[model samples]
Target: MPVKIRAATQHMAMFSVDADAAQAMIDYSGLRVCRYRPNRAVAVLMLMRYIDGDLGEYLEYGTNIMVNPPGSNESGMRALQSAGAFIHHLPVDQAFTLEAGRSIWGYPKVMADFTVTDGHHFGFDVTIDGQFAVGIDFRPGLPVPSRFTSKPQVHPTYSHLDGVTRETAGEMTLSGVRYRLGGATVRLGQHAYAAELASLGFPKRAMISSSADNVEMTFGDAKEIA
Candidate 1:
């Protein structure tokens, strides 16, 4: 584990996408989409604001599809054991993180013009090359309290770059969490990636949404998986 995000905030939403549609997005990434059901798959849209970390301060927006763990092609229903994630598009507002992400773990991090605003609800907007990309608003839900220590929970992450596919163990823990049933809103823009998301059905009410006021994560060693 070389990269560490010591402190940050994470807000994310989950949506169910057509398994086939999800697969199409990551076909070239050498990762397999996890078909949780007969025809259903899952996609996660995550927003992260890093206050302190090895990569320094930065903001990141990611569109990711749930994936089947490497070396297994089981009948997609085994999502519990194969909770890997393959990032389809990742956007950041800083250059150093953009370069480090791509070079370190092969994360598909792209430069973007982005901002976050706080009020009754949270707002995030992004533009790429001066073209509008996406806008998202989140209303913090009820707080979930836990007295247990924040322990590291490892999850699989996949990335493909320069004709190489890598797998990493991303361990993270969250504190001061809150969740809402239907408080997330979004708008897609003219960016090509936005269009791609539209193809898979974006700008809709997510199945669920959650926000973590604090987060700590360590990106473990990356291994060639494909």
Candidate 2:
């Protein structure tokens, strides 16, 4: 109850990775990777700056792969629509959020430094212990399909770490959402889990989108993933 559910600005670049590679990553955690096709998986790289929240203000860089638990239907539509994202790497600039997120949702959050700027584009760089981990430069101002926000994008995520697995449902609403097939630069470093990006052929320039305004969001308490 200490964490505040508030507004935040989010920037993201989505990529299609080799389904086998992504499935390997998910397999390590005992989860199943959700595939858009038989051989491709969706990966989302995000940079978020909270304008106002229970933890005040902070920036976070997240690398997530869409996935579902073993029993979940693996059919593209059912799998992709579950909102069962698996967090592979997460770094936050604030300790308050780091602890709160991990305690509440089993989010794999670690303390780090983040630099963000925007003008003609949305940009961010995340550093942990003076080493670059990930960065993104994205262009906004694109057309969004009416169906993109036609319904609430609410879904549950399952996080498994340190021998524990937790599930939390989050309903996210992004204002001024814009969609585009390309127009973003992504960078992944060699340190830590950042190196894993290479296996997915990350920064390959795929689907990109952005929201100039705030992200309306809420997270439910964690429950053991079934």
Which 10-residue window in model 1 sums to the lowest lDDT?
73-82
Write candidate 1's Cα lDDT for 127-154 as tens digits.
8988888888898888887555366678
- Please write out the lDDT profile of model 2 over residues 105-211, one tens digit for every residue: 78889888877777877788888888988887887758566566645577777777677777777777766677676767888876776778888987688676556
Q: Name the runs in model 1 displaced over 4 angstroms.
A: 75-78, 147-149
The lDDT values for all models are 0.84, 0.76
Candidate 2 weakest lDDT stretch, 10 residues: 143-152
TM-score of each: 0.94, 0.90
Clashing pairs in 1: none
lDDT of 2 at 21: 91
Please report the candidate that would top TM-score against the real structure.
1
- Judged by lDDT, which candidate is best? 1
Residue-pair clashes per prediction, in order, are 0, 1
TM-score of candidate 2 relative to the true fold: 0.90
Clashing residue pairs in candidate 2, if any?
4-54
RMSD of 2: 2.2
